[model samples]
Target: MRQETDPRDGDIIEYLDKGRLRLAVILAEDGNKKRYRAVSEDSRELVLTLRQVTHALPKQLSPTLSHEQLGQELKSIRLRAEQLVVNVDASDLWELLVGEMEEVELSTLADLAHGEVSAVTCLSTASLLRDDTIYFKHRKDSLYEPRNHEQVEALKAELAVQERRTQSREVFLETLVKALDSTPDERGTEFDKVMTDPLLRRYMEMLLHLAVAGENATDTGEACELLEDLQARLDHRLKGHASRKAFHLLVELGHFSPDENLFLLRHQLPAEFDDVLEEAAAALVAEGPRRLREALELGARRDLTSLNLFSIDDLETQDVDDALSITRIPWGWELGVHIADPCFHIAFDSPLELEARRRGATLYLPDRRIPMFPVSLSEGLFSLQVGELRPALSFLFEFDDNLNVGASSIVQSLVRVSHKLDYEGVEDRMEHGSSALDDDLRKIYEVADLLAHQRMADGAVSIDIPECKVRVDDDGRIWVRQRRRDAVSRMMVSELMVLANACAADFCVEHHLPAPFRTQEEPDPPMDERDFEHIPEGLALAFALRRCMPPAITSTHAGPHFSLGLPAYTQATSPIRRYQDLLTHFLLHGFLREGRVTIDGESAHLALSQADAAMQSIRNVERDSGRYWMLRYLEETLDQVREATVVEYVEKRGDAALVVVHDTMMRVRVSLTRRVPLGEVVQVVVNQVNPRADTVAFRLAT
Candidate 1:
């Protein structure tokens, strides 16, 4: 008896070729692996294994036949199989065989289909089964497996979807190609009308998502395929990251703004409040006055509108949240720090409060501001504007002429701001300019100086570094102002806020209440004398000290803030700008009113985690967006050579080092041929700058 693996010369065979069934004629036996040398239907010569052969029909030809004769014979068999397959309904055959059995032999299937078991019928049956995506499958040998009803239905659905996707891709490609070729004038109104189609709109949205996520996009398969298609069709070569190419395409089609803020979108930081949040803010504005009057009538709230309270901030500041006051008593001076009461308006866990908690802090972008609260509330109704009576959580302290605190207290009060002053104006007048409050400004600076000396004596670490503030107007004009970090009026405001925060935090500890207490541990392996002796440059020295300090973190438990030299501290000053401050305000309010914290330690810890996560994203947006605009500034003034100070060298040979540009204050690594000493100022040219890519380079001026 002959084994099934044996194939006679010139036997007709059906075998798998690249996942498709192809008809082939066996020419000779290959003794190795028990495979055969064969000629396929396309007249291509190949070796086929016994496992790959789905069928070896009971038919033969002369072994001495020429190759052309074999090709002619294979073509005739293929033609007959094609003609027979026209009448073979795969689904109909499956319906007949599915209920009776799971599988049937190929020759039996061929006999069932054509009433005969021959090479022609078997090849025809195999061809029909191979092409049928649903109903039947041939895994191995000459067996045909009939799929169950459920499997067949699923396959049909999948096949239908694939067909629709194919058609959709074709239509989308045609529409995009036409749009890409359109004249600029034709693209504006008429092309926008074409984008009204839902399918095209979906494509534009996908591109926008890809642009925002950049290299981090998850659904990149379709995005990559779409771009590859575009690259094949377009005249100019597409380049750069896949996301940026999508961005370029969107800009070309007028679907996206050319200068779209991808950072905001990628971070999911909302640029504007929706209608619901606006309504919540509007409701707060409407209910604020009534609630203030009720609290005052209840008699725990103090009324200090008669006090000459004044706020100092930048000229462009709108959400002025804190003000200061001083008065002489028999033994000492009474100093008052009154903070605007936004937390008093927002109920705990309300939508507005939750949103504030989510934002963590107000994001100040170069060109715009995204406030923690809606503008109507943050800038208008809740801001401590001059001459307007507003509810405040006021911290009062009595200090001697030496500015030593004798006593301090916290109270919910009502106050009116008498003056709204800027730092520059106050700084100018405190020195010599004669203004009505010049004397008061001088006295406040003296208090600030006293507080600073006290903190330093308490082991405070002070590092002052000048920062460049960049602003872009609606007209697209860029203004860069260098701010002195230790200016007198600014210091006065800073020290006063620190005093209030420290005293409030002490109160929380006294009451054993949990709040958002900002804590910073001392620098590990703290900087010593040798660390400071190395850097002589003032800016570099200050920056190195800053690097030695550990970052401050917020917690539900109270602890020392080493940098501020405060035994206890909480940020309750900028409720208008920071969410954690507002939360602390809420905790303070409940303790002041009910003699207990409304939020437990666990709840406060949970809020801290959420706010910390949000604040990280906020910081990334601020840093990345800030750098982008700085790069843009460099691009704007690329012709000018900037003064860059050599800060440090990555290699001791000084072939590569980091430098800080004088005007932009951007620190970047530069390749250096000359051995530049530390703190040496060198003229450097803007060798390369691309704001969108967040890339910039500097080279020493030759």
Candidate 2:
């Protein structure tokens, strides 16, 4: 127990009402009743009370002044002063003590007491008073004792240490933020020494962990703030190991995709498709030169070199897969289609075969070509170069004058290419009959035309969409060349390939062999036959037809391909470029050699299933890379007005219409204020293009 200190006149005390603190001054005291007449410091209105008062003032006080003089002095002070009353009994005061709220000083309260130091600096509460001494409980929920000067000094010293520590931490945090803004190479030796400190390293590690945890934070704004803060601290050059770690952390935080970052930073694009090349090279090295020598010996090859076989492809084509030869027989003509025999060299279930299966098709890009097999075989030994005797899987067809097949046979044979001609040269010879082998070229064109006409009559759909070829000059300028579409040479080659594939499909079905066949379901009929007639020629008609057709897919069972007008179809061409075509060659060669196919239905299904993922990857690489280069092209020809035709209005993409530039053959999205009818030609100016994001924007020309 402790004695309570009696307050004289003009003393300031805190009145606690429902845990609220109100500072009141004692104007007069009644000794008999032990009560005081006080005026509130804020209101200056006198009131009588018996409630407990808290001593929040200093121990030293001015001598008691007469009530009349006190009232007059208070009125003058109130007129000249700004009122700042701190309610000490409130929870806010407790928050300030624990450093959870803004800092407050006892000196500010002392100034408000107007020279009555005891009224503001005392820490004793009236509730704990006993007898005539004021007391304080050292521990919460404990008995009180008379507060001493030594205890108060010790408490003040502890609070001073905490304030200094807080100020030091704030200075360190500000320095760290400045260091993050500098590039790793630009950061001076001073920063390097500061970062080596153990305390600083611990703080940095803690911040990194906090950023990772924010990846799944419910508040997106909070997550973004954390990422932005961390990014600001990253070194611009990222030369150090820790800087590189920070770069990867920012990437994982979803700031940008890996491709966008690589392009923006001018780093080399990732060669994800090169894994197939690595696996192929390893397999070839393990097999050694002896295996290659054995493959070239052609011990099982049939001799068909006497036939005048020839191949026609693009001037830049390297993998010559199919060749054509024809001989006049008693009925009509014997047509022979020879495909390079890669299946014979690469055995089934071999390492090379597995690698080829993993890469479903060779990816073609503007800058480079990724071959399915090594160039040594695809463009060298196994390629059907002129006058080179190579092993081939030959499809021989005996067709009548009406271009109807009477009998067909596939055999493993050795064929010598008599001549290699490009599409342009073939077209020239076909039109003017100027070549030395004019009769042979003319006869082949006649048969191709008849085959194409018959197939179209059988409901074959031809979508002739032209694509632009991207070329890079020595000085790094991009050029786009639109490929010739629906040319006589293109149709001639396409019809022949279609004829051979149809025969191969018929052979598989007739022999009950298991093979993966290309199939397409019948699409919905057009609203009217005249709707297609109203569409413009060339690319516009092709776009309209493509929108209505379902995508072509491969399946284990043979089905009708409405697009090709074939009841059954299986691709057997381009064995060196496409794995599915190679698989077909393997099946056909096995049947030709052993009188039956070795592949079962289950194996065929597995091949198709495995091929789906690889094929999708190839398509994505081709499509994205092509668009990247196209946008790069637009970057060079900025603000140029180009003629374009509205191919279709895409309703799902909000007010956008798909348009094709006539000169560049580039498809772009145009912002449309109103619906634009299909096939309407319009002028558009390039507004913006971003190669990293593969986006291009166009504005309608006035």
Candidate 3:
């Protein structure tokens, strides 16, 4: 039965041409094992080898005869296929060929008879019929067809799963809505309470303005005044009476004095909440002396008769950088600002300092912080402590109410801090109408604001982007939360810093000092101002081209930073964490005390090279950390599908794009075709989100 040959059997013919017959033992039973040995080769190899015998065979013989008959047949096969060596079995070549031919249709056989067929053709009539049957089976099994009860059940199961997922999201949103509804009022006098909370002083400062909107009102303003007053009271209640209404009333009624500002800033509140600002100031005053003493032991030199100091960190023995001195001169009272020489004390090659340099600056995170200096120095001896004499490089300038500096002095001096202060305590007195330190601070703020206003008016850009902040509870669960910045906190810090930066920059430039500038440049208004709601493609295209174009001068006045609305700015505060500030301190110290510039043209060139690389590394690290936190935050909030815009798209090869979610810039890989428009919102299904890599992959949902 194994070897029988029939002329009509295609399998038998194929076996006769390519397969070899073998003798073997066969056992047949319930449990049986048999062994057989047979010659086997690839089907393509067998056919090619057999084709070699064509020329040698008789002209009248069938063309399918074996290649061994003719030398010419062997030569032709070798020449045609150099890659494959073809060989045929001695015994079953005829049977195998005949078996292979069994499924060929009669019409195809007739075509072969007419010399119209090629053995190596990719598709055969036999294969076509089989494919059609398979396709038909697949179609019948599809969900739309549902050929059987089991398949129908499976389809229903899938639909149910989708419905449950959607319902889960709806439920989550409902809970969120309930939480919002439970709040008594959206805006409340919690601003008053913030004045007492150290960490929340800035937050309260912003609310106070809203709280006292109509303290003084005209008869014509009653309608508007009543509405604002009601709103203020409502907000105050919602905030749980965070604002101090009685104190605010005093100031509004002109019964408070500047003396009250100083008193309240220093006074302790009822021991209910931990005031971060007062704690920070106390820490500075308490621990700053310790750090300064260490600096002295390390060989720092200066007279300590007049320094004033403060800290923003809770005392934890960290390095401190700022100190101040006030001196009485024959002409007038002179004020000097001094900062610690962290670099000098740290040494050129110490591991601690190297790490600090690599970090470029300290990074402030929501729940934790990464300081540039070790806690020992950042919060301790190097800090300027109240009532403790410390050495410093100070800048003294003579200016009156008009805020013009005439005669200035820079000297290495020793000084002591009279008191520690914070934004909240300061703001409390400012609005409550106090006189303690009001005149001095108000004067200072007026100068700072004037300088900042000039910069903004000069085409500097400042954007007010609100942010959501995360607060954690004691149990490691996320709980209290609020918008990140308020007006008083934002403007006060901004104006003061800008003025200091401008002064530092001018001083450096006048002395031909080289320093890293905190520069902002204006982008075309169309590019910066264009909203996603209706983007102007022409403007976008032009902006992109400009970004790609090289500049003639790499360093030119960017005019006012379109973002900050400032013509020029550079930071000269917070030297402990910010590298620019530390370097500025170094340069200013030399110019003021030694009458010399620290960085000349050559040194500046070298500093820029090192500084640029350091800055890039720091930015990348910061971005990566932020991305990681954001991804984790999203995973927890995934059930809530908040509306978002498409801010950016990263191009990739061959039908794929990485879409950046608006605001966070979290990127997700997505399939792309010519159909998708850039910077347009489209619903997407998130398949995976990885916090480790800070990435998300999604498919188009609609």
Candidate 4:
């Protein structure tokens, strides 16, 4: 049976393509065979088909435009495109031309429209044809095409879904903002409601996106202004977890205030001294004293408690690591340098030892301190406190009346400090010559003077640069004080400590113990004497010499320390504050107790490497933090004209000369009209302070 169906020209119909209905237009039909010549709306091509045609109804076609009229309209569009400075919406033009043409004619019009617009607008023809709103929507039976009666319902359904989503988002934003403006209790309730609403959750994600985008904005002022505006619109304080995250993002973007506390951020400073370290310290403290007492009762320690041992340090110092004692001998006076024995309790690879190794060294900052060990251990149990019997590593050096070292020996002993004196108090006693310990203090000073002279003769360099101590008081006010470089009390302590370290190093080398040695190679080619010819033999000379010296380094093998005038050197004092010193004590203690070194060369090297890396990291943090605090201090004293020494004159950038301030240890780019010589004292007014960037700027005082 040849059943025939009638379809007129321009009648939109659907044909099967792999079981899916695809839109096509009936361009022509063969009545005799029930075959039709149809053009697909998508491809705009004629095809002969016997497949079933799907249609709702035929749409009434508008009056067809003559070829001349179509050409004129396309020419007008091209003229407008050429005159246009920005992209314009051409949907209205598409609507006027879409319904009046046959499928082949529409295709020709599309090509003309694309070519003319693209030539003028610099848009590709492919881009114009692919845009759904511009060209694809005009096709019959398209989801977006208005002329398709069947697809119009589908378009309305899709739009309704989008409109609902937009409405829900607007309502959520409004509600959240209003809640932020309300009281705290009301705000909490509103926040809970917003978070619980599934429809509003998507908008919350939008807020995050905006925050991240603002953080990454190159224009900081614009970004900050935008963030402030958003905050005002939301009426939120940006205080919760999400707000904190946003704040950190802003910091990462370099948009933070100068006073921002960056050290609180994770990994900004070492974390090995955190609360986890406190746990390990507590465990060590609990068992350490008992073990020391057991060792002492078993005759494992030489009792030197009767000697007049005393420690001298800063007024605020608590970790008394080293003390001095003197006894009269026939050939010479025996000078005993007793260092607190933390290694007696902290075994190698133990939790306390590992924590100490991880910390490497104690960090002292203007505002705070990160101690190598907990105060309960470093300052309490292991400190050589007055009247407390503590185990120590004693270096006994016999010095003749001429202050020449006769012999030296390292011994483990139990000692009780007679007094805990501060540097100022000791200095006062030395000046007045009235204290009970005056004679002993005087003899100590004499020996220190001889030791200094001996080291100077041994080609050792000494830089007597006074350190500027920046301290923050309890009231948070900063004070900078120059520590006296030539104080007799300081020299006495330093010289004795040096002697102890040198003796410890000699002991390690003699016993063939595996210990990390501090070594400094001799300067190559040596420093030119002409560099310091103009400078007086004082601080300036020392500073000039310091610029020529190489940095000291640590290694597993023993080597000479040219700066300390030692054949070999190892830090055995201050075990409470330094890991290397503690490791030295460990090696010495093990050798003394077990008759041979306990740590193998491989283990010593590995530990030394880890300690060296950690120390270097800590030093970097210390330097950066110091600069940060110094800038903070300058912020408080901004615009004040202060006396400063031009340590070095760096490049002249425009009208400014970069100089390092001797007092504050800060580098400043100072605006100057004339050249400034190095070491020239000038008055400078601090013009700007940026603690976040660790920078300060200055202007020459008129």
Candidate 5:
């Protein structure tokens, strides 16, 4: 007798323990004695074993029953079990099941097997259950046997339906992805043929109408009314805000305007749109703009009063930049720093104001800009240009022993700005202790340093990341240059700007005006840890220990930005391009004049939300653009023998990984890593560079 294999789901088990029918292909007797059968037990589900009979058993009790036994006759029949080469009729079962029974068939089992195929396919023909309509795939808990024709047909029908539905969904998703990648023809128009096809359009329309009617419409007239009401409700929610407006701006650039863009941006209603839609867009654009400009111009026309005169320069434009006034008021000196009233120049419903509202703020990119306002206003009329008299809100801070702002006063004053000094020259004189602006400017720098130190001592973390400064020649070819922060060039400019911004925020909050403050929320702890994966095990642990201290408070009000370690941070310095700063200027100007901040708080809040979204979107665009250029640079450098250190390792999807080269932080896919430990120096030859994918591949050389 052959030894039995372990009885797995597909393994045949013999039950003829130690004699008589041992090794026999055990057959149980039925009413038709000509057919034979075997049975197996499943012990886990019941106290006594239950059997799955190989062939159909008789419905009635066998004559082997006795008088006493017949009174309590068993509901099931038992077959003498045995081991036989488990065989199943190939014609009766799927090939996927019994094909693996022999070495010849088992060789290609992976290719032949499918998720839905049965395991009985591997069995030989001798195991046929022809007299009984046997179910090769036995489902537990089902009482009805496959011997019943209706049950067999029902199970097959369910499987077929499910397969069809799954295939249809997959086809639909593939088509959608393809459509996303498709570009329009030379005419720059893409028709939604699949979506707007006559048949699909009619079906969709019917479904939409049915859905509306189901929500309490009694008759056709009532249904139409309900639909109109629902449409109005949806339109209100879909009204485009700054974020969606900016997205539409991009779509316009791409030559593809979605429905959301059409509905919200009626002003840019394509020439194709009927006159009604165009008029509606124009009206919306006009309303908010008209109000904003009326307010701005009112402030701009005023003159500075009750303040000592300061030098003013008239640049070719009058867009307010900065205004200064010095006064010896009573016991101490008062310095008035006035800014232009942009809110005055921007009308509530003007096109320029509407565009500003859409953009939230100007987006600064490496090579270009998507400005928040039209240049005519941002850099011209509303600008507090050098030598031009413009209205501004002044902050007079009284300093005593330590030069700290002990007492402060805010005023709305119309004053002319002195010469506009760029950071480069202003910082140079201060660093050299030059007498260009008196020693007073040097004293300010000294106080600023002290403030920065205090911030760092309070557990602020500072990470200095290098940026690749690209200098593009006239031909548009980039010259990669290292842009490192210098004390006078970068740090000083940053500190003063922060000081201004912090002051502005304090002013707004103290007066109960809703101001858009720039703040950063820290990443979650788990994500923070994951970002350090490429670091060496030892160094990573050291970094983790150093930064393990919990932050005192998640929110910061005043003092140095814990992130930058600078005291008194704010950014009111740039009004020409940034709308937030311009708006801040407006609010400050209003508070100076009225003793309280003016402008709609709700509108300001909406503007802030829109600006943040635009900021993120622009950042993504910048990062991708920089990466594209970096890849191009690497492709050019591939031929030269370049020395690099392994700075990091990034795990890519299966069978692939990225190795970042030190200094440049450029990543390359390397095909070998079985022996190389992370951070260990290994030479590599650049094998291929794909500029299109923005990726490079390298061969690891020992």
Candidate 6:
């Protein structure tokens, strides 16, 4: 159906030049290999390889033509090809040929498209195929492949988006400029005025994304450019990276609150349960009681609900993780540390587990508590609610009066809390007198104090720094409370938790089970009591020994934790909150129940990797959000002289010193205009505080 000519010297050919087809006439053949010197359509001279030549037209022209004549001939051929290009309906040609074959030669396309075989028809068909985005793609040797329906639709969607972006960019920019001059009355206080527009919605979302990702953004798109140009128009002028600029712009546009919890967005910690995940959680919550009842009835778990178990937490605590019970055994004391077992319902790598694993741990912010599990389960089923039967991973420790652990064992159990006690209530009872459970509380504290002394003898470095719990009320009021570490209730709870974790780690090691063990390498230079005897028990002194303490790591291997004074340990408490602890429960529960592996060593390490990736972000969001609220509190107390103690000089960051506010015990960095000795208390005035930016600047009041 088609014919073509071998190029001697005068034939014109269609060839690829920078991915576009162009008409070029052969000026001379270079050698026996078919390489030729040719003049392109624009009369540029170049050597053409055979691979570059799309095809040779059957028509020939004079070989010894002048450069001007060659240019004229090329232009005429291009004009005819372009005119014939309009006649080739590419979509129709695709419809005709798609059912026939996957790929077709250029001459076949020409015959199908124009009902004839000629240089003009071939050139026209190739040009149409190259230019059309939705129909076909160029294959090798002048073969063109028609995209399938799905591929064509995908290309059409992409091209449509590109078209919308190209068409909307200038228009959106114009609307944004108009918005800058718009008064509050014109748009109303509600941001729905601007968010109603789809383009502006995308623009604001991109701004949020850029602000969250900052320099780590994989692609800034035109968001930064648009922001830069907006700032340029404002003449209110800023410089440097556009992330901060984006944040300020959102606030200016009234799209974001001044005290927006940006850390939540920046870290992308989930703030609410997704619908599908929430449904799964509801199903699990509905099934939880049945599972526990069956386990208890079948004697699969220890029925310890009859024991006088007690839970101690803060007054506002709902998602309780651990409860305590104490009873005297014949040989020694038996202390039961019961923990809420969320993994009893959560399957391995299930959707809820995956979400919890990605979340790393429950996040406690000043104004919000982002629960790792949905509230349907976390605060309801999995929480050790008072007087309710709940599944638990219980650790029983048998110890002598000397605080010596004689024997320790872990078991899955069902527990009913007999009493719910707050830290203050427990501490009040311990300090004064109580009518009920006085012996149990005192015995537990006695064991805790004795255990602490034993740990001190074992070279444990105990540094208890008081924390500030900041809360923001619905009325925009900030409350900061000094949480003391010296409370008897807190101290005994801490000691017992450490003991349970140590025993759990020992259990894993004894059984040679793979669990998430928390280990810390020894400090380069060990710290002793002498490091603290000189400094007062203030901010820097609290960190005297802890400063040298290495960070604890969660791994599948058993190792010594220098800070805990334990040869090996793992964190098995807070399974309701920490995914690592959930992983531990899974490993232990599987082994203790079926003597089989649910999460093997490889899977434990994989969960550790996934949790590690999100744990740092979770921690960063926690600390940063706390600081944001603390700064907001201080913002209300601006220009007030507050006492701050210098913790240490942060030379690595700048000429600054970290100081802890005496009232709140919240640590912040202050720029040093004069030398300040470590642990030196100074009066400072808060000059400016922006919680959104997490900036609090202070100067010496003296």
Question: Pick by lDDT: which candidate is best?
Answer: 1
**lDDT minimum window of 10 residues, candidate 2:** 126-135
Model 5 lDDT-worst window of ten: 42-51
Q: What is the lDDT of residue 142 in candidate 2?
A: 18
After TM-score superposition, the amount by which residue 347's alpha carbon in candidate 2 deviates from its true location, in angstroms, is 1.0
Candidate 1 regions exceeding 4 Å error are 1-87, 95-98, 111-124, 178-205, 230-238, 293-300
Q: Per-prediction TM-score, please?
A: 0.90, 0.63, 0.46, 0.68, 0.46, 0.72
The candidate that wins on TM-score is 1
In candidate 1, what residue range of length 10 has the lowest lDDT sum? 1-10
> On TM-score, who's better, 4 or 5?
4
Q: Work out how many backbone clashes candidate 4 has.
A: 0
Q: How well is each residue in 508-537 modelled by candidate 4, as lDDT tens digits?
A: 899888788889988787766786776655
Candidate 3: C-alpha lDDT: 0.43
Candidate 3 residues lying further than 4 Å off, grouped into runs, are: 1-338, 343-355, 365-368, 385-389, 393-398, 402-410, 418-425, 433-435, 438-443, 467-475, 478-486, 524-568, 639-702
1-702 in candidate 3: lDDT tens per residue? 122211121111112333432111111111222221111222122221221111111012223443233233333333332222122121122222342432433234323323333321111221232222311112211111112345435655876776775564344333323433344332123323334554344322333333333233223232333234534544543321223342343243233321122111222112121254335435555665676577566545565553334432223324555543334456654545565555434433345444555556665443445565555455554456566565555555666545555676445555666656555655655567455455445544555566566766775434333344443334545432333233553465455555456667667766767756655444444444344344334323323434532322212122233445544555666767776576666667666646787456565455445545565555554554455556566666665443333433455335565554433434566675543555556565556776633466666665
Ranking by TM-score: 1, 6, 4, 2, 5, 3
RMSD of every prediction? 3.5, 12.9, 25.2, 13.1, 18.0, 9.1
Residue-level lDDT of model 5, residues 466-526, one tens digit each, is 4454333456565676534444435544444555566787776677666655554333352
- Residues 1-702, candidate 6: write the lDDT tens digits: 011344668877877788877788888889877688988878788898877776777566786887678878888867888999987678998898776798888888888888887777777777788789588888765678988999888998999998898667666666666766788555343346446778657776787798777667767867888887777777855444788777666666666677777778877777898899989988887787888889889987889988899989989999999999988788888999999888678788889988988988989888878898999888998899998888899999898866687888889899999889999999888878666597789989998898888888897877778877889878888998888787789999999999988888888888778889888998877666686676777677876666788898888999998877899988889988898888888888888887776667888898888988888998898888888788778888886789989887787456588887787776677776776667888887887887756577777776
Off by over 4 Å in 6: 1-167, 173-202, 214-221, 228-241, 252-254, 400-404, 528-537, 649-658, 666-678
lDDT at position 588, candidate 3: 70
Compose the digit string of candidate 1's lDDT tens values, residues 1-702. Answer: 122666778888767778776777888988777788888766777888877776687577665777677778878977898899999898878878987987788888899999998878888887788788598887556776888889998999999988877776777777777877887666665447546866656665677788889888997788788788878988646578899888888777776666677898899987788899999888888887787777777765798888889999999999999999887788878889999987677777888888888888899888899999899888987799998768899999898877787988999898899999898888778888676567767877788899899999998988887788888889887778888779888888999999899988999999887888989999999769687787875666776788788889888888999989988999899998998888888889998889887889888888878888989999999888888777778788988988877777777674788887878878888888777667778888999989888888888888
Please report the TM-score between candidate 6 and the true structure: 0.72
The clash count of every prediction, one per candidate, is 0, 12, 85, 0, 57, 0
